[model samples]
Target: MPAAVPLADNAVRHADGQGHAARFDAQSTCAVIVTHGPDPALLQQVVASVVPQVGHVVVFDNGSGGVDVAGLLAGHRRVSVMPSALNVGLGAALNRACERARELGFLHVLMMDQDSVLAEGMVHTLGAALVELQQGGDVAAVGPQFRDARSGELAPFVRFGFPFNRKLRGGPGQRVSCDFLITSGSLVPVESLVRIGPMDEALFIDNIDMDWCFRAKRAGLSLHGICDAQMAHSIGEQLLASRVKQDGVIVHKPFRLYFIMRNRVLLYRRGYTPRVWIAQDVPRLVLKFIGNALFLPARWQRLVFMCKGLRDGVAGRSGGLPG
Candidate 1:
């Protein structure tokens, strides 16, 4: 295959034994796209959308079932694919990506999922907002609003509020402070990573972002959300509408339920969880248990996973689910 070329605007090419690892100018941000058996077309779409906005893009594949990521990214010198033979979980993968970003001398890194597509000017807007927030005080990260790719529904920015609640805040284009932001589309400074520490790899998937955000807050850093910078992403398996509620209920697969329950329980036990989330989650968990039992298909299996998740979470069993 032909060698990849440098991107526009003085992008540097750092040669590795395998191929070239592109480096961007100091002003440019490094973008990290983590993938796990992603759909080929969607991955291409996301990569294409982000490459122009950032200086370098790392496509970190967490065990992609033999997908040829390098082959897919061929001819794009600024984009490189780093694949793992086994799934290292999202937190671990992101930590690795950040390390690579720092090694490349990138001041900031934008985290993205393979499935999500960036909106027009999303990266520029997020980068601008991050810089703007940093000028004020210690800002850990800045994230964009996420819209459901399927339904075109927008998710709200979140903040911890009175009465122990995680209140959704603000509409599009409005900048606001938030308790935690999703991993996807978050622009985090390398300095903050050094100060706050890497993601909690043990929890693996769920609540890792929240844990990081809470730690940043504890370290006197603020997390902000820029509503104008939006990403088209997926939240859950499905959205179930109800006449009694203004917002629909989100459903998830059994495996996801395991991580969701276990991670939250573990976070609470470790004192990493904010009181507000606990207050809100406790009642939500209770209702979820009942709802899944009464309505979801494969009811018994779902219950078993949830129970196992709770048990393991309490017992502090982590690093991929036990067989």
Candidate 2:
């Protein structure tokens, strides 16, 4: 593999070898996971699922206090974790991990969310699909079909289509192209990251994947979701468990609401994001606002945060919300 730009710094890599690095070939893929205050038991399950599937694994401990990450998953020879003293936002944490993956000479990086647990052969399925898709040289990344761990829902892939956004039942490596994919369970070539750039740290949390995917499309690259490759993962938002008429509107906590609304506005202003998405998202936001206001927990507080996010986003503000 050719050299990639510098990526990691200040992450403490424990265990797994001699103070040196080895360069790997295109066949090598490293799983780079970002974790911050994750449940130890859940994190262990996530680590166990990934370790057997990849060439190497790097976990970034983004300021989770008092967690002995290494000890929790001790005796795993292929795993190495980087601990941080303070929390870096998801994008920045991933940037370091991807950089470290490159530094370790891996040709590909698998970005895994801390909560996502892979099914058996999921990595192989995704790897095979990626190898086949990238043969044409226009592929950006390949993600998996995920079953929502919370609701047992089989999520659909989406494409930007005329009249409305089209939900895909199939993905790239087939005839259709996916508009965007969630960051977790996605296999990205190291080279593509170099070309498309890293996640937008300005987003902090929400819409990071959308921002990256949109940028990739503007670069003339295509993303795919492999139907056979699957994972059990929970999305950030929860569907109302009661009689709330959500009507597909998702609600987050008040704090998360701020980032969702703010980063959404940020993405809306970016030239690289497709006009179709911009058109589609506005109504969704309206619905989300209404749903959240009417039935979401702490509705008033969430609304205040959301409106503040909108104001700040329009004012070109970025990063985490103020206290």
Candidate 3:
């Protein structure tokens, strides 16, 4: 056989030192859900829900607060646990998992967050949409509708439009051609991932998915929403909040405000044009900074984060948020 081509510069080589061929046949698919020291019950529920639908489950553990996730998954025949010694940020951890999944020969990899629970038949729904896209011949990635767990209502997937400051909202059950923003419950094709390369690890946590989706779009792949498939997510739970109910219960968490203010500017500078930044984003960011400074505690930290994001953007730094 002819020598295999390297999928990426950092791609692992087979025993003979050439890149290995992909493992999955045309019909088979693999799903990987990333977790970091999540509640064991939630992990079990996530695994139980997903294992039945996919060919295999690879649980990417990013330093789970000393949780024995591997032990929990030990007896399962189809589940494999890969542990990281420390928290390497979401983008890096997911990229590492994608590499392993690619090597295992899975055609499609579903990138899932720990707090989100897959609704019944969610996997099949996404998979069917992917197949439809593939048959249509131009689809690159597919993401499902994300619903708030408490209210049972759909949430908006943030779409950062050009000219930086403007964002177009994608509603639940709406099928649209997106400009590189998908939420936690998204499915990525292994071939496209290899072609586009791993996500920017420097992003560490926020906006990494959007950055990757943008890159995929730039690489000529189409991104779509599978309107039927839905995943219930506990939004703002990781950050502490006093809960209140609207359409669903709203958690008023302070950390989310900080991250949002800091990362939104960073994303615009790195992914969008400067004109967009100056026209749309800067004023909004300034208003946010002022509001946070006046009302939120740890005002200095929020301001510092905003300044750092601006500086980084001006310096042409794209991947990773400030440490």
Please report the candidate that would top lDDT against the real structure. Answer: 1
Candidate closest to the true structure, highest TM-score: 1
- Displacement of residue 169 (Cα, Å) in model 3 is 8.7
Candidate 3, superposed: residue stretches over 4 Å from native? 1-27, 157-174, 238-266, 269-279, 312-323
For candidate 1, list the clashing residue pairs, or say none.
none
lDDT: worst 10-residue window of model 2? 15-24
Candidate 2's residue-wise lDDT over 1-323, tens digit each? 12322223222222213321122232377899998878888998998888877777888888888887767766675778888888878999899999889887776789999899998888887877776666665678888888878777678888876556777766434534688899999989787899899988878888999999998989998998898888998876675455543223354678888888888888888887888888878887887778777877788998898899888889889987677
- Model 1 Cα RMSD, Å? 5.7
Error of 2 at 315 (Å): 0.4
By TM-score, the candidates rank as: 1, 2, 3
- At residue 134, what lDDT does model 1 achieve? 59
Candidate 2 vs candidate 3, TM-score winner: 2
lDDT of 2 at 301: 91
Candidate 2 TM-score, true structure as reference: 0.87
**Candidate 1 segments exceeding 4 Å error:** 1-27, 162-169
